[model samples]
Target: MRDPVATAMQVCPVEIATAVLGGSWKLTIVKHLLEEPLRRGQLKRRIPLAPDRTLTRQLRELEDDGIVHREVFDHVPPMVEYSLTELGHSLAPVVTVVDSWGATYRWTIDATK
Candidate 1:
């Protein structure tokens, strides 16, 4: 089946970007991954508010999008780690700018309240 959103994104760069990054937790996940590679458990602990299924789904989506790389290590108990790909690393500066904006926005809102 054809994806309408994917088709629309072809004509609109903004739409393509939004489609890739519009999820609630994707950016947050990316932000954490920027620090270093983290195991699934560690990432989940960092994002306690997000449900397990939701986090799993978001991680899968990111992996599909080439924004995240999943590494599986053979050990006594199987270990999986996630890190940003080079394409994903390109978003670090963008995320930093967005985070700065969010902080400023929150500060302004707090001052008014």
Candidate 2:
């Protein structure tokens, strides 16, 4: 999605959720952050497919949507951590359902193969 928080009206609720979290790694990132805050590098390791630039952009979009909280610690090297905001945490049920669906889909595909 070009913009996570679409300003347009008449958008379906599901459309809004997809608009905000449709990126390849956005939901996965939220799923991880739901457990605990993670440093930038940790997220990189967890989502290796997301290039550094792509991850940064997705994180920025999540932050803009009030779905993620980013904290920057001043150090010799800046340390940034990402965690879920209240809005993001609210998606726990949605993530859970998606996770379950994905697991089932994976199993079905593997069985077919």
Candidate 3:
């Protein structure tokens, strides 16, 4: 097998961000945002795969990359919603492909267990 650390270090910055967001909940978050905006609690309820800390980290990375937009609503409840930025909308096609591939390969992947 290749050296994971060396391979990681060789990746460009943009690629690194992609790899980071490629974690369990990140793509799921983006995929949901493709259809509609969701508040933080809603996202949490939708994706129970990862811990909040991990999901939060992924969102921060996406926001830093100009892919995800976070909107804070001032109110007694203080609502916060996360949506895709223009750059994020560009990822719709990529997410579509990923979704297709996941659906196609899910059975094969599960069988390996």
Candidate 4:
């Protein structure tokens, strides 16, 4: 868990949710993992905007929060994959709502322009 999630006294449900989910690429990562397990390189390609370091950090945080499962295969190159935990899968509805809201917001902005 991140410092804010672990160390701070957050009282609001929304605040606690944000603490766990509000990092730069966190939601996007979760959204992608909702579909299927992916390799590190696959996630990097999917979220090309996030730097490797940022993806790595958010993934670590999510793992700490018990939202994602990271599995390693004993192979010549040590393959790794990431998949959403039961908790992470629970975010599907939230992700769908947010995605819809963002598209509506963009449409609204374009209409005004």
Candidate 5:
């Protein structure tokens, strides 16, 4: 028979986790927001290569998943800020692991060589 650990690992595939968080800018957005709340412009500045429409769509998906909270301020410019919901907070540790893995694995690519 197969090992229990192997069976469990296969039961919950990494692809499933990646599917939830693997989009181009999703991890970048999550990493940027891990510390504090941020406005749309601030996020745009943080990840300039990300298209505004794509970012909006991902944020909407996160919000629908109960992992992000959107707050709107009634003001002259109509301020809007996003921060983690309780659910999102639960994801922080998972995100951190992924971040650390990227940090370690990314160095393998020799940019100049």
Candidate 6:
């Protein structure tokens, strides 16, 4: 079966990149996942500002994009964990640079003000 997301992304690398990582929260989630796998609740705690449903949607989108993997264990309460895929791991450097740029930009703006 053809992957619709991949197919759509083929049109333009930049567009697809933005489509996959455009949102404010998606990159943040990716940044955290770069550290270690986390449970949903833990992720939520890390991003306390995100609404529960919004986080859920972002996670679903990330999973769909093949950037993150979700593992579920059968148990009394059920255990679910999220981790970055190999493809996702490749983005660590990019995220780091973006983070650095954001920090610099914020500092520059604050200094100017």
lDDT per residue as tens, model 5, 9-101:
566767445545656787777888898899989999999999999999878766765667999999998999999888777778888998898
State the lDDT of candidate 6 residue by residue for 1-113, as single tens digits: 12545765778888677778877599999999999999999999999999999999889889988899999989879999999999999999989999999999999999999
- lDDT tens digits, residues 1-113, model 1? 12534775678987766677778789999999999999989999999998999999889888887899999999869999999999999989989998999999999999999
Give lDDT for model 4: 0.91
- Cα RMSD (Å) per model? 2.0, 2.0, 5.4, 1.2, 7.1, 2.2
Better of 1 and 5 by lDDT: 1
Ranking 1 against 3 by lDDT, winner? 1
Candidate order by decreasing lDDT: 4, 6, 1, 2, 3, 5
TM-score of 6: 0.90
Local accuracy by lDDT, each model: 0.88, 0.87, 0.80, 0.91, 0.77, 0.90
Which candidate wins on lDDT? 4
lDDT of 2 by residue, 13-90 (tens): 877776788887899999999989999899999888899999999899899888999999998788888999999999
- Clashing residue pairs in candidate 5, if any? none
Better of 3 and 4 by lDDT: 4
Alpha carbon lDDT of residue 83, candidate 2?
94
Q: What is the alpha-carbon lDDT of model 2 when measured against the actual structure?
A: 0.87
Which 10 residues in a row give candidate 5 its minimum summed lDDT?
1-10
TM-score of 3: 0.78
Decoy 5 TM-score against native: 0.78
Error of 1 at 68 (Å): 0.2
Misplaced by over 4 Å in model 1 are 1-5
- Best-fitting candidate, scored by TM-score: 4
Per-residue lDDT tens digits of candidate 4, residues 23-102?
A: 89999999999999999899999999999999999999999988999999999899999999999999999999998999
